[model samples]
Target: MDISFGETCGCKGYSVRSDILSEYGPSMANSCGGGNFVVFMTILEAFIRGRCDLSDPCNRVKPHSEPDYEYDFIVAGGGTAGAVVASRLSENPKWKVLLVEAGGDEPPAAAVPSMIASYWGDPAMDWNYRTEPESNACLGEPEQRCSWTRGKVLGGCSVTNGMMYMRGHKRDYDDWEKSGARGWAWKDVLPFFKVSEDNRQIGTLVSSEFHGSGGYLTTQQFPHQPAIAKDILNAAEEIGYGVTNDLNGDNFKGFTTAQTNNRNGSRMSTATAFLRPASGRSNLHVMLNSTATRVVIDPTTKVVFGLEFMYKGKKKVAKSSKEVILSAGALNSPQLLLLSGIGPKEDLTKLNIPVIHHLPGVGKNLHNHVASFVDFKLNKENATQSLNWATAMEYMLKRTGALSSTGLSQMTGVLNSKYAEPNGNHPDVQMFFSGYLAGCSRTGQLFEPLNTNNEDEKTTISIRPVYLHPKSRGYLTLASKDPTAPPLMYPNYLTEPEDIDVLVESIKMALKFGESKILSEKYGIEADKTPIPECASQGEWGTDAYWRCMVKVATGPENHQVGTCKMGSPQDSLAVVSNELRVFGIKGLRVIDASIMPIVPSGNTAAPTIMIAERGSAFIKNMWNWNKPPIVHDHFSSTDLKRNCGGVRTDTNDVKIDIQTQEREVVDWHKRHVHL
Candidate 1:
């Protein structure tokens, strides 16, 4: 019998072939009792309706059309940081802000926490990037290429990620200051984090000082979790690991239920938290389905003036009267700079593009957290897994059920490997739990049950042990001059043998949890005994050599890529932006996103990126003197201008003199100190 289903884009008003359904009715009934099939269809229909209602206009940011040719600020890429930066900068009611996003608004399915993996390879929602074939890693995958999934939607990867709201260790920020990112110490940037956070469990589940309250971004644990989650936490404690309620609070090293960026069982992306509140502002305009191609830089003056973009099959330019900020994410932001002739002179000349500034650090220092997947089997006869019609109904009516949470996947564990400092503040390894096998089918169906012939194998679960601080660095270069083309990525996963050592240690540590008395007695947990076929020749199955081989074969390069456009002092040769986030040799331009991170944080990157946006926005406001008393034109002299413009004041009496000149002088000062 032939059966056909509708598109999963919005799942609204979609139809199935009636004749095919009728033809296959009896066979489907025989395969899985008639009542069961009917119940499945009923739940499917209800899910479609709920998704459509959640994606309605009232829950999304309304796209703006016919934006003016110029604005006070033009923010490129309305992702995690871009959305927050644009929203905060537009608060003064006097500045006109334009935000350009390459993708459309998020779909209804993105709101469902359990459906996060459904968007992994979907071209409509993900960038679908793959690392250049690696010889040392990803041997099990086709052609040894690791899939790097970045979001193409408005909310960016936050719409496609696990939604874990991790802020990394405080020492991570102090290290940033020591690495030339001055003023980025833990104490200096904590307030910006609080300004964007609205933790629901501030006093009860988290510390009031470490967490925030009464802010836009709502964060809390999912309302529902599987029964197995408690057992997993108990197992961690039994294995001599500290268990805490809050990973983001005082204790960074521990095992606990994850705090997610969720609100009432739905995802609260940066677009939902920041953009939705500022949607009604006349000063803020969001341009969806628009791709920013290049930064328009004045050739002789080396000052950014506007942005070139593609919208509706036509090329257009938007002028920035004040600044053109690039928050296009780590991958795209550096690619845009290379396309705009702001990269190394030798490489630009090879591509026959005239060099604008010859900044050598445009696309260097790339890295990400990498992990290895380890599988285990649980006794399903004793476990209480509730992912059926009754739970589906419960979620549809009251938003409380297994479907409202990620189950055991909502738990995380952080511990220090032998390579890490023994201090609890610096955990080098992290663990992620997946309650079920997560993958997308060829037909795009999501969250399907694992198929296995063995009854015991049907209850398989996975734990991913991630190496948080990797020394294996990679870089990306432009594939061609076309803006629509993807950059050539060289993630170089596991290139360093030290990285493999860390993964092997992490894998050993995770197996201890499976062997703990609590998990063994309560859940009947056992590690999959099958040895990796590719690693069989390395050593004994449980030996360190065998685990090292397994790491190379099943490499998991996480989505937390950062440090391509690292921020540092003017004296640092590889610094793309200064401590203030301004491009060293250019005027009216700054990069405020994950790309500026000198070192990737110890955990997830979304929360820190938002903090960077908040801090960077404040820098822009202070530099422009927003809300400060307007400089009295009659008394505005060179001395006042010098103090405001970093001592680059012009001697002209005209108060309306082009501020661009002063900006150029400031850039020149930094350029002299920057190693060419």
Candidate 2:
């Protein structure tokens, strides 16, 4: 009999297993095949060799041991999204789960609560990516190197991301249903969001009404807002935002206290909360240092059958008896699909890769959060300590105080305009507040050797206003046939005029908040540029032409890339998966991670990503339990949105919708397992 495990222990990433592992293959191999990203290297080399620079990080880890075993589900990429998916799925004792992370698990030096301000310069935990070039944003900065930092360990991006948790406005979900992710409306998905989280600050039922009680994930509003955090919200309120403590409640369009995924001052990454707890479960398996190279499909019908990956130094395959879920993330998921012959025929043909199925929507319709840096500094006393060694000691030992703070003071409010327009339900703009005044210079390699004397010069406080829901779209494509090559990605940011119009309004909204009276006295905040320079060039700064030119050039693209494998109507050219998240025209295969987002959510993707995992876990459980039953870990919900979406479609006479209305077939089995 055959069974699969999840990821192996440690941060070695994912690898395959053979019944004959002892019979063949060497111990510790570098099958990354020439080019790949390295965990640590020189700053310049890292930049020159990174994915954004050339679509491949070009380095591989040389293992110290032999290849290990396989798991039931080998989740590729153990970052923010991967952690929640692996954790929820592993709850069942009858099945094994595996999570493969590309980066090694050693904690980054700046990951400590005390050194939060130094993360940008710390290479141990960051994946810095600079654009080829930009037209408008960061000013007076040496070079534009936008930093794309994400934790490479089990917690993934959660460990590295700003810990602010902002629940989007209700209209955000309303928009999804309108866009084609029909059953996933706000009210429908809210429970999953609440169910997946366990807030450290709120009461269970009171919070559990929208939060989980016994759930592993924990969230706490910032321990101390710091002068900078408090003033930003105060300033926002002065500009007309209704100040409130909770943004997760009814109306999200206002200034509010910051909420975060920190428990007792330590980062509450999904891995720390979800994956780590179940690591010892015999039914769950985790593999580190393994890379899933391709999906094995039935060449005759184009039906997906299993997957192919490298373990240690040898190749191995794992067949899926029921379903194979892809949670490898946006770039990699679509790349894997296209590599296995599931993307556009033309694109596939160009790389000389065979077309197993003409999946036209495979790597198209990309979406990303776009942002810009705005700075105002009055003094240094209120700023976060530049290099405070004493404070660091206190935080590490007791897990108390400022060191534990996630760099963000709060999620700047969601705004429709500076003044309330009696117009739409959705807010037109949103802003993220930072304690560090990061200029637009692209972040250099985290692996760069830092001169010990230069530690005190880091700046203080940055307020970035992200242009939410721009009409612009991007794409992901393979640079080569090699699986080791990172997918070529283009966010195609601000390509459309309509996208630019929305962003223009967003910048003005941020300025209004900066003018608040309460915030100025506390944080020493100031709006350096009274009127945003109109020109893209220095000559146009005070002119309307400069504003227009700056609008075009002044944006830092959101690293939250999604919609590459967009989920929507099959008739649409850009729709890769249906609302059920199944690959278009494929059988027994699905793409769950960030790749299937029909539209990006209101704020950060981490919270919403966890909710998606909760829903997907139910979908898989429902599908798998049709035959075999889980003997442990009782799931309480009778009706899950994912399972509900999978069934029942609404139809109009002139047109057809893809809703599946079949009855949930888990009655008798439910009784057997939970004794209901």
Candidate 3:
């Protein structure tokens, strides 16, 4: 009898019998073609090289000592942005850094490329956050509360995120500049984005000027390109949508194979990319499984001095001599600020917590990328093993197969919705096409199985229509005085009529994919064969009301929440932080995370979040003379500024500034560091 344990454990390629291993030893390795060995060795070499760089004075990191108390820099929340911030800040050997993480390290299984889906809700990796019930969305879910999954591990959401390396539209940053966030236009920040990327898969297919080769993050195309990706590309082109060879390149519009932060079939999370090399630094202290309960600020002076955190079930305080940066994610960063008495005065007064500063923007402006799924059941014979024995053996023995892919959305298409302004350059809707049904996987907190009649268990194809820029803003509030208590997240998705109209139009546009000759004629499958039967009971299949009902019942977040602690000028009453990322009312305290985005970008939040950290790090370094100030470009000269109306969308909140104070501060800093 053929023997294989199952998909989960057996995929690593081992047999319970010793005799089997001995028989297949060298010969099996040869048959598998030594591909897996080469891949492993290449990664090991890169890691070693990164370690060597860490020992350099410009990038050195010293391990934390047990007796150490105070640090020059305290970076709270060792997540995607936090890891980058902490690692970069500790490069100066004289400045001791402390990185506090609420989660432990990424597990061994988290390394498996195909097993990426398994880490979403793995108690070992996820924070397991859930949002409060919404009146307009998540109608099919239990209690109408949607699952908001954030990575609790060292890598943060990068550990379990879809792993797409998208930089969003150039207009996004230009809009930030037009909205009062100077020195943040696409050209001003492009250098920093290039500085963080170390693209490994640069060949004839990539643009040399647009990509960087000597950065920390490793970005490349997935080893296994699903057959559906090619089919979809062809179909997309036939339908008149342009095909972009590289989505991260100059052309932001079009359908293409998604780029991921993976190296040699393994997920290259911020933990592995940024933290691993710096983990050995004596000056860099990383406290894992430690939750920062509050930022210790002098209530009277409104100055941050240290932090109180829970570690190993014991409460402890760590002092910061220079500065305390909050790199915690969107939810936790705002939540921590409130717990430390830095939120709205009214809310804090009601909670009986002394208000250090009445920053009304603490937990407000919470929003996310909302998506609705459109699935089509493919012919069973054509279905790939969503995860089966052969694919497992291929991955285990060869390290090159479907198992090596990102396992999330494989292809992305950027296009304008019907409701989009005519002749607009920016695409309002982004569609993700995947071979497997979106929520087919039984595990993971984000996967909510669709209520459908699929007793046949046939193969499925799904397209997720995501609204790029949402207008309906939400707020996160404290459930109680308890710091450990999860914040009550009210996403307030689809509250706006325009948002709902755009999404409904997006679904109609995605329906074209199913109707394409490549999917229906070539594949011999019917477009409406695998209908979301639940919606059929509501109304006729193709009606506006039917699709609207389908959208309401199936609408879910893409997990790209941002803009809670918006970055703006002090004059803006809702502004929580200055353009430098420093809190307006507090000294020695700053927030560097997705929460600081005034308006969510047009694409994935991960890449932009990393870019923010890179820029924020430079800002801090320049303040201490550790690095020279970056030469910023004139935002008015950009093509985006000339073609499109400057500033943010009419529906979005504009980033306003206190220009006189900002100018004065720049002059003062220049005088203090006149030697430069």
Task: List, residue by residue over 1-676, the lDDT tens digit for candidate 2.
Answer: 2212111111224322212122111111111111221221122122211111011011111222322344456566666777666666676666666566555442322233333333342344444533323333333224543345445455656666676776666777777778777567787677567655555555521243454433556666655445456555556656666676667776666776666775545556666567555555655555555567888888787676676776676776666554567777777789898888888899999999888889888888777787765666554333223223233334433444455564454456777753323675666577776663211111223222122345433234566777676778767788889986767766666777766666656666566655667755654456666444334344444343544456555666665777878877777777887766678788877777778887887777878777676666656666566333211122111122112222111111111111121012223423332211
Q: How far is candidate 2 from the true structure (C-alpha RMSD, Å)?
A: 12.7
Residues 1-676, model 1: lDDT tens digits: 2211221222124422212222110111111323434455443433433332234333346577666889999999999999889988988789999999998887655666766665667676678998889888989999888899998878888877888999998999999999999888887777667656667776678986787554667778887887778888888888888799988888888899999997767678888778866776888988988999999999799999999999998898999999999999999999999888898888788888778998998889999999997888776442223345455545555556666777677899899988887665589999998874211121122333433234234466789999988999999889888899998888888888888988999988888888888777876788887999999999988898899889899888888999999999888878899988998899999999999999999899999999899878878877787632111122223343333322221333321333354335323422332221
Off by over 4 Å in 1: 1-53, 380-386, 436-456, 627-676
Question: Which pairs of residues collide in candidate 1?
Answer: none
Please give the CA lDDT of all the candidate structures: 0.76, 0.56, 0.71
Off by more than 4 A, model 2? 1-72, 106-151, 203-208, 379-387, 418-422, 436-460, 519-524, 530-543, 626-676
User: Using Cα atoms with residue i matched to residue i, what is each candidate's TM-score against the true structure?
Assistant: 0.84, 0.75, 0.81
Which ten residues in a row are the worst by lDDT in model 3?
Answer: 23-32
Candidate 3 lDDT, 369-412, residue by residue in tens:
99987777665334433544345445544446666785537689
Q: What are the root-mean-square deviations of the candidates from the true structure over C-alphas?
A: 12.4, 12.7, 12.0
User: What does candidate 1 score in Cα RMSD to the true structure?
Assistant: 12.4
Candidate 1 Cα lDDT to native: 0.76
> In candidate 3, how many Å is residue 28 off?
26
